[model samples]
Target: MTDFYTVRVHHRQKGTDYTLKVPDNRYILQTAENQGADLPFACRNGACTSCAVRILSGEVHQPEAMGLSPDLRQQGYALLCVSYARSDLEVETQDEDEVYELQFGRYFGKGKVRFGLPLDED
Candidate 1:
């Protein structure tokens, strides 16, 4: 028997709040859609931050959330598309760009670009 946890989500962009009964074994985003919650998502494979959220309370397990860094995870960020509820949870949707910047901004536009490659001929 699967244990069910109460999942509360605050969609900051849409200014909406949803409360759902999520099973411990099922992905939260999938279960939310199944329960008629209109949440945002892009890649369902946990490779993107489109479904990112910040955990306000409770625990979530997202082993496949490659989009989220270990430090971010430690800071309570989760990718809902690949996350499972461990306990009753309350989470607020995150700004994807903000999360992206925090996760990878340092790696972007850092050094001088060489534009003399074959594909970069201008």
Candidate 2:
């Protein structure tokens, strides 16, 4: 088993590729359809190539990278969402969309938004 830290991926598709322990936390592309503290993206199947990015360093495991071309694959590119941490790896994701941090509220509704632009009224 391996421990995974909540890492902060730099830009949408720009970052480092340092080795990480196996069984590390999965990757969630900033462009993934489902966005958390991570980035946001479209089709996660790897067919769209919207989440493709260069790997500055580190390694990754992609069980199902459908459209990753040989040239692109040879260039150290990867789909952030479908890939998993194999052994402590680093990657680049500068083109990814930004996902603002969320405010977790207790069951009793104690938490609230911390910061960002204000909302508009209807």
Specify the highest-lDDT model's number.
1
Tens-digit per-residue lDDT, 67-87, candidate 2:
554545666777766776554
Q: Cα lDDT for residue 35, model 1?
A: 93
Q: Please give the CA lDDT of all the candidate structures.
A: 0.86, 0.49
For residues 82-116, could you state the per-residue lDDT of candidate 1 as single tens digits? 99999999999988577787766754465422341
Model 1 clash pairs? Answer: none
Q: What TM-score does structure 1 among the candidates reach? A: 0.87
N/CA/C clash count, model 1 = 0
Off by over 4 Å in 2: 2-8, 12-35, 94-122
